[model samples]
Target: MSAENELLLIMERISDLTATDAEIAQFNAWCDGFKAQEIQVENFDAVSERVLLQVHRRINKKPNVFLPLYMKLGAAVAVAVFIFSVWFFSSRVKSIEEIRYAADIAPGRTGATLTLGSGKKVNIGLATAGDLAMESGVKISKNASGDIIYTIMPDNKVTADAVNTLETSRGQQTQVQLPDGSRIFLNAASSLTYPASFANKKERRISLSGEGYFEIAKDKAHPFIVDTRGQELKVLGTHFNINAYSTEAVSKTTLLEGSIVVSTATSQQILTPGTELINNGSSLQVKQVDTELAIAWKNNLFLFDNEELGTIMRQVERWYDVEVIFVDGISKERFGGGVSRFDSVSKLLKSLQATGKVQFQIKGRKIYVTK
Candidate 1:
């Protein structure tokens, strides 16, 4: 018989005693055979009517089988629909929770060590930001802003050699000024290492860990190079920011004024005003972006654009030094717009919870996530 007729016959026997396991298996085999057919069966109404007729016929023939067969078919149909719905919804809900979980552990804030010229190490977080004299003839002073500035005078030279290193714990942010009249703003859990003096005539260099925004001094004769996480940014004199946090997948360099060159081991690209470069270790993509969004963190704002909850939490974890745990299956919610970083963690959570999709609880320095 034709496939349609066979289906109708099976449907008719669905509630009858003759509709045994072997008969059901035969129907299943027929369905499997036609599974690869490309033709669309456009007569669903007819199929439904035929199925109902088959069920009624079976009920009249074998009343004992009517309830069990109907229940079994109903259960099978319900389970199929449930599985399909779950798959559809899951695909639509990107793995945003996984992203948030990764961001939570990603290292943006935390601890750091300062190594003096004498090879002595000082844990800056434990020590007060006051004048701490080192054996290397250097005096270290930590300002209230959490900057570690050094003053060193060569025993023979009249000019003092001053160096400044700014570092923040995993949940902290800080700013510093270089001896060369340049300024730097560091994001949470970041560090900058610079010399007391740019005595080198050809090139001046500094190393960075995490993220920093720089307003470099205008000295065309001496270029500034920022080294971080396998990438180097060279500038004659420009204002720019570098986000090379080890936890991030891409090292981003955004230029605000003048021009700069970003180079990795595999590629090099030059950037001009209003341009940003994202280096993914193996590839580089240059794009034009709003400078304000790139440097918003320095201005104490959290900007997002259809960003997942996981990404938003990473930023929070860094600035507030809090641990986040998700108790719910994993939030697939995406958030947009911006918020002030100056607000407390609870306030931020409340705003997010306002969406009615998720909730948060703060305990000590840890945040628990629920949905």
Candidate 2:
């Protein structure tokens, strides 16, 4: 494409918030070419200043012939963040119209609620980092690292029958160490219910909703069973991730280490490392997959590998604690990239906007997607 067309295309990509990886790569090339042509614009600051001057000059010369409002707005943002490309772009300024419907919601953090067996709720997010509670002969404490630990006393001969639940709301996450030394990292909008002390239980069984990553302590005699949605994962000792969000199309169980037997009402399969068992309705399928991408949320990163725009937005909706509403319907375009979960939703949305396939309008905490 010609230089003018290429610039317009980049601006268009920025406006629509649907820029593809290849398009972003091409934009970076253009930025390099611009730098080579004008050596004075050596760094991001210089590029931002030059782009700002150029944008103002264009507006001054042909103020009546500006691009569409959205395009102009997007282009302005793209120009501002051109130096950083896909990974980091936070210098963009919001237009007056865009600001009217802007959302400033922060990303999810380490926060959750602990429900004692007595139905009392303790907001762990607000609780101090010390002894949280003692429930059912199990000593529950919050360590300095904000991790919940359950320690059972040796001398106390009380096998109490009580179950405790840990839940994380939208824009929050929490980790808990079970009595058996197993660790569970609960994701936002997820919950895990288990017995306070597993001493009397036949098996280490836990029920999960939403999503969580598990690292089961090795105990071949007492198998660890996870009940999620309509599927059950049976393993002796393993590390895996389960994504059973109600809004998700399917329930997925990805294994990272050890072995697991994933079963449903209709089918069963054995999964090894680097494998995932997907449950769609009553059907089950197993396939080799990338475990890192599956557990990206636990690592504080949003990793999307060829995921549909609608699918990508669903994750964004949960992490940013926002609502997503498609203007006509969901955008079918797919996205592939990774961004820090701690960044503003605008930065993430701006990266998507560069794809040149879809557009986004944030009104309060709701995101409207359109083509």
Candidate 3:
């Protein structure tokens, strides 16, 4: 293909956010070539850089370059492109937000640790797709999609009430299918402990810490019970999310479908879909909430709706496994935004910085926050 046509295709890929790292590097090289040829852009606006594409109408020779420039979405920046002798060009920049780089940290992925009834820990990420173990008349294995699965063996008597635990550390998350056919998604820095077989149990009981999204299998005969730090949630086949991280003083239970009874030491409350029960370690209050936001972490998203900076950073600390040190005089303003949880820590921090309420600097495994 011709050089000009190739440049157009590259620009399209960039606009669509489909360009590879090498392609981006190539584009940058083209820009350097233009500089070598003594061509310069006349205008570059600092604040609303309304794109002014001024390609020099005259040149000493045909510069072997397809110039490149960056445009941050929601921010204005001028861009120019050049190839061969053709000087006139118009390009549309969209979607690709230029993230500030300070030694880029990679995003998190799916991984977890499973502790068997025998107290042996297995790294699910390194385990092969097969029967990981056998205990309590249930077979523990990992599926092709890397999710843990538990299956009951027919005609096999229930052995000891062997309890197993699945845990995910920071920069990790995982899903598991319980022997009762329920599905639970454990968020980063979370763990779930349950019996290997629910065959003889009156209630399919499980203990949870940190955060989890439960999709309980429909079993009206046996209700499911989740024991957390500050609340006990009982339900008969429903979907819900519980956030009871130890670092936070408040715990929440958000129901997505069906109903759940949340019980504290003194009070008991029922939560319907689209509502959340917040336990402030002193009182329990049920309020209507956006269910999506409550389970946003399970959906691989970080959605903050009028959430405090400290509250938001707490989440960042868990998901990225970073220590947050704050200097004095940081704004107490609440901010709102949505960012992909699977992205690097910088992207999330940059989005928060865009609010003009905070700044971040990464040093080793620590994130320093400033006013």
Candidate 4:
């Protein structure tokens, strides 16, 4: 039978007043497959109590009707979904305790800086939506949506090799459309440098100082290249993410859709879709990886799946633009979960604190971590 048929059978069993043990087991197995996304609850115990109360009300209203185990479980799930949907889809929840710090730290925004070839810095975040600059017969403009677009003139010619850089400071992220029509999303504390135009270039190449997710435009004749600190990724129209933070122990290149060749001084490997190549400054290792977790920053999410405390704090430090100081020393514990990047630092910290493995104190722009 098809999956839909199977699901219907399970639902029938759940709704039946006298479901057998085997039928109840099937219903529970079906319900277990359901998962709610983009929902954050502070007090799960309170939420569960409220949900159970609603389910009891539904049960009490139906006189002479018996609710089996599966029916009760299904009712509980429905009630919980209703409660969380109201909290998540609506405004941010105010139920969580408001943890106060010395200073309020807001979340990051879509912002970056454009460094012209002449060394002049233009704050893209503060600049209005209009023509920003012109270089090598290409017009650079920012749309109302804060996307930096580059329009290459029909008669575009590069007299000199002029390079422009776009950098996002801590607590900022931005998108840029390259002259080649490729789009890139730079994460916090990331930078991308490219030539004014690729008119006469044999290959489209750019340098990235930090993490950037790329959707390379297809060009059969000329390949695209990304140069990190000591690694290079060659692409022929693909979607990928590269995390080459200098502070990171190992640089990573994760392929999402297409193939990519990751090259270092010692080795080179072609990574297939769903493959990740880790460069440890000497050699390259390829392994199957979770593409969603690798490029979660571009989607405004902090997915820490079994990531170390120190690693998670590093990401928080960049997004909050704060300094992390260990009270005694860092813990070796790792965590697995996710939270919205749109949330305040306190909410994210509270989520971490709920694990009971660590504690945090914020003072001004500094975060003190304790175990």
- Provide the overall lDDT of each model, using Cα atoms, as 2-decimal numbers: 0.66, 0.78, 0.75, 0.77
Q: Candidate 1 clashing pairs?
A: 12-54, 100-310, 109-170, 109-189, 110-169, 110-170, 162-196, 163-196
Tens digits of per-residue lDDT for model 2, 47-95: 4544444444443443323323323455445443444432222112223
When summed lDDT is taken over every stretch of 10 residues in candidate 3, the lowest stretch is 86-95
Which candidate has the top score in lDDT?
Answer: 2
Which residue segments of model 1 deviate by more than 4 Å? 1-114, 119-165, 328-332
Instruction: For residue 273, give model 4's deviation from the true position in Å.
Output: 0.4
TM-score of each: 0.62, 0.75, 0.73, 0.73
Compose the digit string of candidate 1's lDDT tens values, residues 53-94: 444344344333443343346544533432343233223223
The CA-based lDDT of model 4 is what? 0.77
Per-residue lDDT of model 3, residues 237-339, tens digit only: 8999999999887898999999999998999999889999989988999999999998899899999999988888888878888888886654577999899
lDDT of 2: 0.78
lDDT-better candidate, 1 vs 4: 4
